[model samples]
Structure formats: structure tokens, C-alpha cells
Target: MRLRLLVIALLTVSFLGALDNTVVTTALATVAGQLGALEHMSWIVVGYTLASTVLLPVLGKLGDMIGPRPVFLSSLVVFMLASAACGFANSIWWLIASRVVQGMSSAGLQLMSQTIIAHATTPRQRPKYLAVIGAAFPVAILIGPLLGGLITDYWGWPWVFWVNLPVGLVALALASFAVPRIAGGGRARFDIAGTITLTVGLVALVLLAAAPGQGVMDLWMLALAVLALAAFFVVELRVAEPLVDLRHFANRTIGIGIAISAIVGVGLFSITAYLPTYFQMAYRTSATVSGLVPIATVFGMLVSNLGTGWLASRTGHYRPFPIVGTALGAAGLATMAALPVGLPLWVPMAVMAVVGLGTGAFMSLIVAVVQSAAPAGETGAVTSTVNLVRQIGSTLATAVIGGVIAAGVAALLPVGLNAATLTPQVVHAADPALQERIAQIYRDVFAPVFGFLAVTYLIGVVASVLMPRGRLSDSSDVVPAAESVTA
Candidate 1:
């Protein structure tokens, strides 16, 4: 019963954090209109993403230094408060500021939830629980836009933020009772220099990827990211207690796990971000119906995630799941790339389900692999590092994919067909000939994007092939060192 409550609490928190990533997406237009900041609407989402991405490692390190429970609870409190602030904001800047704070707290919630689970469960038992927690993200992504649209339509756009208050309170209550107090590593000193350099690098890199226009600014951001990251590496090497221990990457299992995590991120985000747009533009589906299209993918993910977790936990050897998964994902993506736009919707849905099956296999296993190999004391840091890499991968891929679509549309669309104004309504209301041309443009543009995603999954297959084979440890409290874990 107690274990059930803990898992419930963790799942709720995970959903809350992940949901915010996409929930506001559908509400952006409503928000911009009401808040009178049409030009700055993107900042509402960008602010949250930036804060959360930059804070992952910082919060993870804090969890390792002072234990996860307190960090978890503190983050929940801040998240709830910021959620309220977001709901009540009368101006766009206020809402954006509140979202940034909410995002910072969300980083802690996301990182500590995983860390707490890692601390609470053994390697052998971790997969199943992590599987449950892992499902929250895709589930949240699946519902976020739909839910946001409903709330924005029925109540108001603010309700989207307000809704978190109730859910967060419930999670807080359960977590307060169910989470065990785990001790942290005794070290209290923080690597200020390392944090600064890393933050600078990550911010620059993320901005560069997410930047709207290209040229001089992009070059400057790239140079700044490169220099700051180089400095971060040097600082980590010299620091007594680094923010991110550079040595973890030297471990074969850890390295492979991180690599696969990034690839999975690229594949997952690139598909989810663009598919709805494709449906709306090509199929002329309603936003609500378009949002529902990914249900097939999420369903496949949930089924495979749970099954793989159960099987891995039972057998102890976990190496085969990702290998099989990545191959399936590659084939599925290749099929999707080749699919005709005129085909029945169910056909593409089926293909995405196959992609989801491949994705779900990796969701929990990579975390388990990394946590299993990390020192018990450094579990939080290592877990956060892997998650951070995944976030970076997703962010970069989404931006690149967006660029691909934008460039393709620009070249293909006739003169005066402004891409920015080509909403579903506009496309559907156009003359049949124009509609056909627009749909064809989407088909041509997205085919290559799908191909790019398939290539990523192929890379995942290679990484999975190189992964060191080993059985997960059975002891609940012991994390074997990297060398000891290798068979």
C-alpha cells in the first residue's frame, strides 16, 4: 500500500512537470490575444523550457548533496505557488515570469522524482516502477494539447495553469507521507565556476537551436556555447567536487546509455512535434482530432514500456530490449517516410505505433542501465546528466526539424502564400487546387524529416549493439561500480 502511494505520488509529479511542457502550446494564441503581447507569445513557452533545461543538472546536484526528499517537496511547493501566479497574471510579462519560476521548480520535480525512485528501488525492481513513471511523460504529451484546448475553451486559458494546483496538492500530500528520507553525500561545497560555465554553454546552445532567425546571432551563440562548454570541461577536470563529474562518461555502460537516451529524445520529439501539424495541414483535421492522432504512438509506447520492464526485471539481463527496439523503430520510421500522403490515416497511425514500440523499450531501460552502473552516492547526478542530454537532443532536433519544414515550405509555396498564415482553416478554405498543392508541399517536406528520424533510430541500434552486456543487481540499496557491473 505504501509503495503504491509512493509510485502514485511520483507519477503525478512527473505528469505535472511534463504536462506543462506542452499544455500551454494550444493556449498560446488565446494567451497572446488576451494578454496583448502577440509579438512575444513564444517567450511564454521559451521561458519555461529555458529555465527547466538549465536547471536540471543544478537541481540534480542539489538532490545528491542534500538528499532528494527535501528538494522534491520544496519544488512541489514552489511549483504550486508559481502555477497560481501564472493563473492570476494580468499581463504577459507577469505570466512569462511566473512560468520561468514554474519551470525551475519543474526541473527539480522531474529530476528528484527519478532520483527518489532510483534511491528507493533496487536495479532489478527499478525498471517496472520507472516504466510507470516513464509513461507519464508520453501520456502527458499525448493529452497536453487536447486538455489545454478544452480548458482554454470552457473555462479560460488561465485554467490551464490553475489546473495544476489541485493535482499538485494531491501529489504533495501523497509524497509527504510516502517518500522515505534518504541521506545525501556529505559534501556540501558547490562548484560555482563549473555551474556558471555549464549554464552559459547550455543557454547559448539552446538559444542557438531555438533562435527564430539565422546569421550573425546564430554564429555568436554557437561560438559562445563552444567556448563556455570547453571551459566547463576544464573546470570539471580541476574541481574537487564538480557539478558534473566528467569521469562518468568514461564508463562504457554509462556512455552508451547516455548516447541512446539522446537518440531516443531526437526520435520522440521530432515526431511528436510535427505530426499534428502534418495531420492538420495535409488531412485538414480539426486541432482536437489532429491531437488525437498520436494516441496510437502513445498506446504502443505504454504497452511496450510495461512489457519490457516486466521482462527485464524477471530475467535480469536487459541488453536485448533496446537492440530489438531500435531496429523496430528504424523500420517503422522508414515505413512512415515512404508512406503516401493520400493513404488512409490508420496506415500512418499503425506505422507510428511501431515507432512507439521501439521508443518505449528505451524509456526506462536506459535510466536503469545508468543508475545500475553509477556509484550509489552519485546516482542523482548521473541520472540528471542522462536526462539533461535527452532534453538537449530533443530541443536541438525539434529546432532542426522545424527549420527543415520552414525552408521546404518557403521554397515550395507559390508567391504570396505566406507560410506563417497557413493554418488548417486557411488551407481547408482554400480552393481545391490550392489545398492540393499545400498538401503536396507538406508531403514533400515531411518525408525527409521522417527519413532523418529513421536514421536516428538506426544510430540508436548501433549504440545498443555496443552496450556492455550485464545482469542488473538484485540488492535494493547497492549500486555496483561500472567495472563490477560489466560481465
Candidate 2:
């Protein structure tokens, strides 16, 4: 009963985290138009991702030392408050600031949910819970954009953020009642040096990636990001209780899982971010209609996630799923890429559902593999690492594809347009002819950007080939809580 309650709490938390990502996608145009900063709108999404990526490992380790319950509750408080802040934001900067806090909260929610399930349930039960948690992501991903579109089109943009408040409060109330006070080792000493090094390195990398290639020609940003990452590695090797244990990568199955996660992240983020643009440009659909594609994807994920869990339980085998899933994911991506600019309206949506099916088939399988492979105490750290890679993958996709879009815009636009003039305010301030030119450039650039995403999915296909065959139920391997790094 306690475990069941924990599952319910985790599902709610997972939904909140996943919902935020897509909730703003459809509303971004409105936000930009209102704030008069269309050029920087991408950062609103990127900021949350960057914050979440940097903190995932640290938060996971924090959960292991202090216990997942308190950490989770604290994260919920921060997320809910940030949601309120976002709803009330008067400027883009305020919205970005609130998103940063929300992102950090997201990291905690994701890690704690995983840890809570791992600690409370046995391995056999994990697949079912994993299915539920896994479904939350695709479901939220699908709903966020559609909901954002509907709310923005009818009610207003603020409702996007406002919607989270009531849902978060309900989750908080349920968690308070359901969460256990499991005592563990007190708060472990955090690795300050490692934390700073990793944070700086990742932030630098993301910022550099976010910058339009034509805007600043500084290769130094790339160099600095590399240096910071190197420093993090050195600090981690020497720390007594490193936030991320490097030794875990020695496990082949775990390594494969992380690699696959990164590639999948890259593919997933690119598809979601760019698909709406495609629908708007190619199909000339309304924002609400464009947002419906995710619904199709999520519908597929919901079914496949449950099906994967059921199959794993019945067969006591898991490797074949990743192998088949990645292949299908790649095929779906390729199909998306091949879609003619004039393809039937429903074709893309169907393809997205196929892609989601592939995602559902493998999402939990990889997490389960990594968790099963890690020593018990280190589960949080290990789980965090895998998740971190995925976050990094998403960041990279956004940066790279977005950069490509920016570059394409710079080249294609008439001589008058620069970053400043591209702002929605500046664009509106310009003559109608210039606005037409800028709009054309945005449309022209997205096609190739989406093509690049397809390649990333193909890479996932190769990584899936490296996945190891294992079933948790078959092996009674009990990794103590102290040893499992929650990757």
C-alpha cells in the first residue's frame, strides 16, 4: 500500500516535470509577441533545460544521502512557487528567472521519483512503475503543447503557467500524506569543486551553443566549455564522495544505456521543437492543430510503455526490445525526413506516433538496465548520469539545430536584419516588406534542421545494438542502497 502510494506521488511529480517542457512551446509565439523579444524566445525553453541538466546528478546524490522524500518535497515547493512566478511575469527576464528555479525543481522531481520507486519496490515491480513514470514524459510532452495552444488561443498565455499551480498543489498534498520518513545516512558532504566545474562547463557550452554562429565569432567559448568539463573530470576523480562516480561507466550495459539516452534525447528534443514549426510552415496549420502531433506521439507511448512492461514480465527478456525499438525509431525518423513538403496532413502525425512507440518500448528498459547494473547505494548517482546524458543530448540538439536555424536566417534575410532587428518588436517596428523577408528565412531554415534530427535517431539505432540482454527478475542481485548510484 505504501509503495502504491509512492507510485501515485511519483506519477504526479513526473507529470509536472514533463508538462513544463511542452506547455510553453505553443505559447512561445504569444510570449514573444507580448514581450517584444522573439529572437530570445528560445532561451525560455533552453534555460529550464540547462538548469535541469546541471543539477540532475547533484540532486540525485543529494537524494541518496538525505533520502528522496524531503528532497522531493522541497523541489515541489520550489516548482510550484516558480510556476506562480512565471504566470505573473511582467517581462521575459522574469519568466526566464522563474524557469531557472522551475528547472532545478524538475531535476529533483525526476531523480527523487526514480529513487523513491527503486527503494520502495523490488526489481520485479519496477517495470510496472517504470512504465507509469515513462508514460508521464511522452504524455506530458504531447499534452503540453496542445494545452498551451488551446489556453493561449482562447483564455490567455498566463493560463499555461497558472494551470500548473492547482495540479502541483494537489500533488504536494498527496505526497505529504503518502511519503515515508525513511531514515538514512545524514546529508553527505557535497563536492563543491566538482559541482562548480561541471556547472560552469555545461553552462558555457550551452550559452556558446545558443549564440548565433554569425553573431559572435569567438571560438574561445568552445575552448572554455571544454576546459571546464576537463576540470570537472579531474575534480571528480579526486573527491571522496564525488557527485558522479566515474567507475560506473565500466559496466558495458550501463555505458550503452547512457549513450543511447544521449542520442535519443537529441532526436526527441529536435523533433518536438521543430515539428510545430514544420506544421505552421509546411501545412499552414494553426498553433492548436500543430500541437496535436504530440498527442499522437503520446498516445503511442502510453500504449507501448504498458505493453513493454507486460512483455518483459511475460518473457523475462529485455534486450530484444531495445534492438527492435531503436530500429523502429530510426525508421520513423527517416520516414519523417522523407515526408515531402506537400505530404498528406495526417502523415506526419502518424509518423510521430510510430516514433513514440519506439520511445515507449525502450525508455524504461534502459533505466532498468542501468539501475540493475549499479551497486545498490549508488543507484541515484548512476540513474542521474544516464538522465544527465539525455539532458545533455536535448541541450545539444536545441543548440545545434537552433544555431543552424539562426545561421540560415542570417544568410537568407536581407542585409537590414540582424539579431536586434529580428526581435518581434523590432520586426514589427520595421516595414511590412522586411517582416515578410524575415518570415521567409525562418521557414526556409527549419527543413534541414529537422533533417539533422533524423540522423541523431539513426545513431540511436547503432547504440541500441550495444544494449545487453538482462532481466531483473532472473537475477536476484541485491545492490545495497549505499552502492547504487541513481543514474
Candidate 1 on 1-487: residue-level lDDT in tens?
6777888999999999889867888899999899899998988988888899999999888888887888999999999999999999999999999999998999999888888878777889888889989888878877888889899999999899999999999999999988878778868799999999999999999888877487898989999999999999999999999999989999999999999989777997666878889988877777767755688888888889989988888888889999999998999989987887767778888888998998899888789889989987888899899989999999988898899898898899999988887788998889989988888899889988889888999998999999998898888443221111201
For each candidate in the order shown, give its overall lDDT on alpha carbons.
0.87, 0.76
Enumerate residue pairs that collide in model 1: none
Q: Give RMSD to native, each candidate.
A: 3.6, 5.1
Report the alpha-carbon TM-score of model 2 versus the true structure. 0.83
Which portions of model 1 miss their true places by more than 4 Å?
Answer: 284-286, 478-487
Position 477, candidate 1: lDDT: 47
TM-scores for candidates 1 onward, in order: 0.94, 0.83
Q: How many clashes show up per model?
A: 0, 28
